[model samples]
Target: MNGILFEKMRFTCQQSGHCCCDPNIIVTLTYRDLLRLFTTLYCDFRLLLQKISFYTLDSTTSPILEKQMVLETILTSDGKVIPGLKKHSKKICVFYSRPSCSIYSSRPLACRNYPLAFVKEKELIMSTWVKNSPKTCPGIGKGSPLSQKNIEQRGKRFFKEIEKHNQVVRELNVEASNNRPLTAREALWTLIIYGESEYQQRQK
Candidate 1:
C-alpha cells in the first residue's frame, strides 16, 4: 500500500496519452531531468525556469513535514515545503499535446516507468502499479509480458541518477535547516545549473 510490490510486472503504453495527461499525477523534476530538457530543447536555463513551479506540502496536515527534502520544499517566509512541476491552466501536463507527449524522446524517469514503479528496498527492487489502470491504458494486459532485464536496467539507471541528484537536494535542505535558505534565484541556479560542486565544497 505504501509503495509498489513487484519483482517483475507486465505493461505496455497504449499510446492513449492518459498517463501524460493524468489529472492526478504531478511529474516531479530532478536535476538530470532539467539538464536533459534544456539540452533537448536547445534552450537556456531561464526559459526552462518558467516551466517549473513549486508544489508545497501542507505542514499542518503532513505528519512527516520535517522529513521532506529541500529540493521538494520552497523556503517561503512562511515555512519550508516540497516543490514540483507547474501544470497548464487546464490541469494537464505542460508538455502534453492532445494525443502524445511533446518530449517523449527524453522523458523523465518517472514518466519512463509509468504503470511500473520500482521500490528499492535494501538490496532489491520491487515493481508495482495501479491495479485497474487499464481503464484508461488499453495496452495493459494486451501485450507480451514486460521484460524484467530491461526494466531492471532502466530502474538501475534511474535510481543511480536519482542518488546523484538527491545529493544536491539534501545539501539545499541543510541550508534551509541552518537558517541559510536559498533565495528563489539562488535555488533556481542550484537546481538548473549547479550540480554538486557547491555541496562538495561544503564538505571540505
Candidate 2:
C-alpha cells in the first residue's frame, strides 16, 4: 500500500453523487455492508437481492484484471463473483435517488471512504486517492485539511470489516473446492446468515 501521509491531504464531499452515478465504478460489498442493508431494508432477503448485482469474470476478461478480481472478490458456481450495487437502466446506482444515495446512512464502507483508500504498512497507515474515482470529482482538493487521527480511525474500522468478510469468503471457497460449490444466491444467503449471527452476538 504505497501512499502519502493522511496529514498532507484534504477532502470534502461535494455531494454531487458522481460516484453513485458513475457507471464505470463498481460498489463492491463486504458482509457488514450487506448486513447493514439487510437490517435497513427490513431484513428482507428478496429486497436485498434486488439491490445487488453479481459480476462474473469470463474468458474475455483480461488475465490481469481477472487475477485481481479473484484475489479481492467472492467466488460462486456462476463464476468468480464480485457482488456490487446494481445499476439502473441508465447505469446509475440502484439507490441513487436524484441528488444522493437513498440509503446514505447505511451505505457500504467503500462508499463511506470514497476518493480515499487506506492501508496499514509496518507501523503506519497510508492513504491514497482511489484509482477509479471520477476525474471530475469535486471533493478532491477543495476542502479543509484532513485529520490524521480521524482518517486512521476510519481506516481501522474499514479494514476490520474487510478482514472479517474475507475470512467468510475464504471459508466458503474452501467448501466449494471440496465438491460442494455454492451458487451466487446461496453464497449471499450464507453471508446474510453469518452477518446476522454476528450482529446478534454483539448485542449480548
Candidate 3:
C-alpha cells in the first residue's frame, strides 16, 4: 500500500452522503461490524439479514481484488462468500437515507475509516486515502490537519477487530473443510454468535 503520513493530511467529512451512496464501493463487514449493527437495531437478525449481501466470487473475480480481501473467503454451500451491505435495486447503500446514513453512529469500519485506508508495518501504522473515494469528495484536503495519534489509535483498533474476525473465519473454514460446508446464513449466524460472546466477555 502506498501510504501517506497521517500528519501531512487533512480531512473533515463534507456530509454529502456521496460515499454512502457510491455504487462503485462495496461496504464489507467484519464480525464486530455486524455485531454493532445487530445490537443497534435491537437484535433483529432477520432485519439484519435482509440488509446484507453475500458477494460470491467465481472465475470472473479480478486476481488483484481477490488478493486484497483482508478476511479469508468463506466456503459456503452457496459459493466462496464475502459479506457486505446490500445495495438497493438502484445500487445505493441500504442504510443510506436522503442526506446521511441511518446507521451513522454504528456504521461499519469500512465506512468509519473512509477516505483513508490504514495498514500496519512492523511497529508503525501507515495510512492513505482510499483509491476509490469519489474524486469530487470535498473532504479530501479540507479542514484541520489530522492527528497522527488519533489516526494510529483507529488503525490499531481496526486491525485488532480484523484479527478477531479473521480468527472466527479461519476456524469456520477449517470446520467446513473437515465436515459439511456451512450455508451462507449459517456462517453469518456463527459470526454473530461469536461476536456476541466476545462482547459479553469484555463486559466482565
Candidate 4:
C-alpha cells in the first residue's frame, strides 16, 4: 500500500454545485425494487412484477428519481412506472433541494452511502467518490473515519442485495429477449468491480 494512502484521506468541500451536474451516473435496482416501484405507480403490490414495462424503469428515463448511479436500463416503454433512477437533469441530484436530499426518507440505497461506492468484479471493488474536477462536497472527507470492518459489513449486505437484484435482472432480460444471457460477471459488476485494489489500499 502507498504510505500516502493512510494519510487520513482529507478533503474539504465548498459545495459550489458542481457535483450535481455529472452526466454519467448509473442507478441499479432490484427485482424487489421493481415491485416496490410498481406499487408506487400502480398503487398495488399484489400484481405480478412483470405488469410494468422495463423500459420506463431504465436509467435514461428515471435517472434522478431515486439516487445517482450507473446500471443497465430496461428497453421497454411502460417500465417507467417503477421506482428506477430518476433521469438526470441540468440540475444536480433531483433530490438536491438547494442542499439536501428531498426524498431522504425513501432515498435509494446509493444515496445513503454517498462518497462511497462499490465496484463489481470477481472480488468487490470499492471506490471513493470524486465529484468531477470543479465540484466540492462537505462530507467528502470530514465525517468520522469509517473503519474497514464497518465498510465490509455494509459491503456484505450490499452484495447480497445486488446478487438477488442481478438474478432478477437476468431473469427479466431472458424473458424480455430470447437472445443469449449475459455472463454473471458482466451482469453483476457491470464493470465496477475493477476498483477493489484502491478500496483495499485505502482501508488501512
Candidate 5:
C-alpha cells in the first residue's frame, strides 16, 4: 500500500440489500469477471447471464463498432450510446438474492467498489467514495476507517487487468471488421477464452 494519502475512510457493509436491490445499479462485467463466472458456473455465461453489447464509433475499427465493455447499451437520441447492464423486472441485479448477493465472493468490480470509484492518472490511482454512498448505504462512515492502501491496490489491479483485456478485444475487433463481423456471442467467447493458443491460432 505505498501511497501518498494517509487518511482512511470509514466503511463497513451492513448487508441491507440496498445496492443489490437497486434496479438502476448496473454491474459492468470485465473479461476477468466473466472468466471467473465461467469457472464458477461451469462455463455457462450463456445460461446464467445475458451477453449485452455496447457499440461505439472508434478510429481503430473500420465502419464498425468496437468497445471492450459489453453491458446493456443506452442509446441517445442523437444515436450516441453508452453500454450498461440489464436489470431484472424490479431493477434488481441478476445475482441479487433476498438479503444478499448470490455471488458475493465473485461479484463484479462495480459491485465490490460500490459507492466508491477509482480513477487512474499516469501512475497514480485515486479513490473517492461517492457523495450519495451514505444516503443509501448504511455502512459508510460507520466502521473503522478503510485503509487507503487497500483501496489503491484494488484499483491498481483492476486497471491493470482491464488494460490487458482491452488489448485482446481491440485485436479481435479489428479482425472482425476486416473479415466477417462476428456475433456478440463470438466476441464474448473470444474474450472469455482469450490467451489460449487455439484462439490465437484461429485468429491468425
Candidate 6:
C-alpha cells in the first residue's frame, strides 16, 4: 500500500497561477540575482553599480532623504518585529503571466524548486512546502508528474547552495563591520565569490 501511494505521488508543473499567488513566497536575492536582473531589464550593470544603498533596520520618517530603503525591519510598540520587505506579487514576476514562468532561465533557484523547503541544522535539511490554500496554482494535482526521488534530490542540492549563500552573508557582516559600508552588490559578491562550492572544493 505504501509503495502504491508513493508511486502515485508525482508532479509535473503546469505553470498554473498558484506559484505566483503563494502568500508565503519570499524573495531574497543575492549578487547573482542582481546581475541576472540587470541583464533581464536590458540595463548596463555599471549603471546600477554607482548607486547602491545600505539597508539598516531603523525607522526614518524624515522626508528630506532622497533615497529610501526598499527593505527594512520594523518593531512595533508591542515589541513584535516585522520585515519591511515587499513580497513578490504573482502579478509582478516577469515570468508570471497566464500560463508559465516567463523568465525560467533567469528565475531564482528558490522559484525553480517550489513546494520544497530547506532547513539548516548541522547540515542542509529538506522538507515539503505544502500550501493549505493554493489559490493560483491549479496545476498542483493536475500537471505533469515529478517523482518523489527527484524532489528530494533537488531539495538537498538546493539547501547546500543556500547554506553556502548564508555563509557569505555571515562573512560580509564581519567584513563590513571592519571596513566601510557594503552595498547590495558587494553583499552579493560575498555570496558568489565565497560561497561557490566549486571554488571552495578546489581549495581543499
Task: Write down the lDDT of every candidate, Cα atoms only.
Answer: 0.66, 0.83, 0.88, 0.45, 0.62, 0.48
Point to the candidate with the largest TM-score: 3
- Per-residue accuracy of model 4 over 3-43 as CA lDDT, tens digit each: 12323444444444444444554334554343334334453
RMSD of 3: 1.3
- Model 3 C-alpha lDDT per residue in residues 7-117, reported as the tens digit of each score: 888889989888877788898899989899999888999999999999988889998988898776888899889899999988999999998899999999999999888
Output the number of the lDDT-best candidate.
3
TM-score of every model versus the real structure:
0.79, 0.92, 0.95, 0.52, 0.73, 0.58
User: Can you rank all candidates by lDDT, best first?
Assistant: 3, 2, 1, 5, 6, 4
What ordering of candidates by TM-score runs from best to worst? Answer: 3, 2, 1, 5, 6, 4
What's the CA error at residue 132 for candidate 3, in Å? Answer: 3.1
Determine which window of 10 residues in candidate 5 has minimal summed lDDT.
Answer: 72-81
In candidate 6 the C-alpha lDDT for residue 160 amounts to: 55
Q: What tens-digit string does per-residue lDDT give for candidate 1 at 1-204?
A: 345433335566778888777777777777767766766767576767676766655647565644533234546433553445567887888888878888899787678877666667796765667444646666666666767677678778877877766777777777777886776556656676664454456699
Better of 1 and 3 by lDDT: 3
Error of 4 at 64 (Å): 24
Show the colliding residue pairs in model 2: none
Query: Over 4 Å off in model 5, which ranges?
Result: 1-8, 49-85, 195-204
The RMSD of every model to the true structure, in order and in angstroms, is: 4.5, 1.9, 1.3, 11.2, 6.8, 8.8
Q: What TM-score does candidate 3 reach? A: 0.95
Higher-TM-score candidate among 2 and 6?
2
Q: What does candidate 2's lDDT look like per residue over 73-179, in tens digits? A: 56678987868889999899999998888999999888999988876767576788887563768888877779988888888887788878888899888888887
Model 1 clash tally, residue pairs? 6
Q: Assess the local accuracy of residue 123 in candidate 3 as a C-alpha lDDT between 0 and 100.
A: 83
In the predicted model 6, the residue pairs found to clash are 11-145, 11-146, 12-144, 12-145, 17-136, 18-136, 18-137, 31-188, 95-102
